[model samples]
Target: DTAVSQTPKYLVTQMGNDKSIKCEQNLGHDTMYWYKQDSKKFLKIMFSYNNKELIINETVPNRFSPKSPDKAHLNLHINSLELGDSAVYFCASSHLQTQSPSSNYGYTFGSGTRLTVV
Candidate 1:
């Protein structure tokens, strides 16, 4: 079974539209995250949900929101989308534990949803 999964792997929308992407993980992890990959392939985490608590990156715009209905899911919602928002969004999950060489619990990322705004 897939450890992590996302729906609607591709999205094409017009400016000023609203959209949402759903993500679910079966790794039994306590922490899940949303990362945005720009056209340059630069990855930057936007929001993180730890055990259903939302922790958003300060740099992220208020228009973007992360909703964790449960520990195994983190869904992203974008309102009044803009062209600048066009990018590949990735959903990832990781064990909620201290990281060490012997206890490394790395992140498992979804296939990614490529969003385009015209």
Candidate 2:
């Protein structure tokens, strides 16, 4: 079973349209994050949720919004999507416990949703 999964693996839409990407994690993690990877493969953190509380919201455009109904789900909604918004959106989850050599501090990432705005 996939620890993290995202729906609509590929999305294609027009420039003025709106779109959403759904994500879910079954790892029972306390924190989730949304990251955008541009054409150059630079990953940027867009938003982060810790136990349903908003934290680490980056300087993304206001057109992008993240909603989390619970600790296991985090959805990204974009309004008036633009060509620049085309990228791979990734959903990741991790436990926020104290760091230790045996502890899993790395994030569990989804396959990624590739959005294309034409």
Candidate 3:
């Protein structure tokens, strides 16, 4: 069984369009994150939500939003998609240790969603 999963494995849209990627984790993790991997394969953290609360909001554009309806779900919404937004978006979940914030367990990543904006 897949620990983490994302819908619309491949998305192709035109510029100025809007898209949303749905993610879910069955591992019962409290923390979930959204990462974007560019064509060069450089992964950048876009957002992180812990227990339905926004925790880490990287320097991503305001057009990009992360919404967590519950501890097991984290979704990414992109507004006015641009060509530069073409990349693979990965959804990952990890068990965050409150006692030691840095001591987080390994993350389980979903099969990335490849977004192509023309």
Candidate 4:
């Protein structure tokens, strides 16, 4: 079983289409998040969910949406995708209650789902 997993390691689509990426974590962590790595390799938080509470970063677009069916999974669904939406999407998780050292506080990311829109 993987600690964190995301499906469709690579995705190529046309602009204005809609698609989704699924994520799951078996680490029993209470906190989970989605991050986007742009072409420039800049990592930015898109959404964070902890104990059923959703914390969204300010920079995310309305076209991007995140949903958590339960504590074990978080999925990303995009509507009217744009060329700019093409990027590497990563799913990660960490222990919420047990705070780890700075080193341990690092995210355990999925292999990454690469999205390319033409």
For each candidate, the alpha-carbon lDDT, in order, equals 0.92, 0.91, 0.91, 0.90
Report per-prediction Cα RMSD to one decimal: 1.5, 1.9, 1.7, 2.2
Q: Which candidate model has the greater lDDT, 3 or 4?
A: 3
Clashes (N, CA, C under 3 Å) per candidate: 0, 0, 0, 0
Q: What would the per-residue lDDT of candidate 4 be over residues 1-118, giving only the tens digit for each residue? A: 7789999899999999999999999988888999999999999999988875788999898888988888989999999989999899999998763444653566788999999999
**lDDT digits (tens) for residues 1-118 of candidate 2:** 9999998899999999989999999999988899999999999999888873676555788899888988899999999999999999999999974557577688999999999999
Which residues of candidate 4, in runs, are more than 4 Å off? 97-104
Q: Write the per-residue lDDT of candidate 3 for residues 1-118, one digit (tens) a residue.
A: 8999999899999999989999999998888999999999999988888964686555799999888888899999999999999999999998875687668678889999999999
Flag regions of model 1 displaced more than 4 Å: 97-102
lDDT tens readout by residue for model 1, 68-109: 889999999999999999999999998864646668677899
Best by TM-score: 1
Off by over 4 Å in 2: 97-104
Sort the predicted structures by TM-score, highest score first: 1, 3, 2, 4
> Candidate 1 clashing pairs?
none
lDDT of 1: 0.92
C-alpha lDDT (0 to 100) for residue 21 of candidate 4: 97
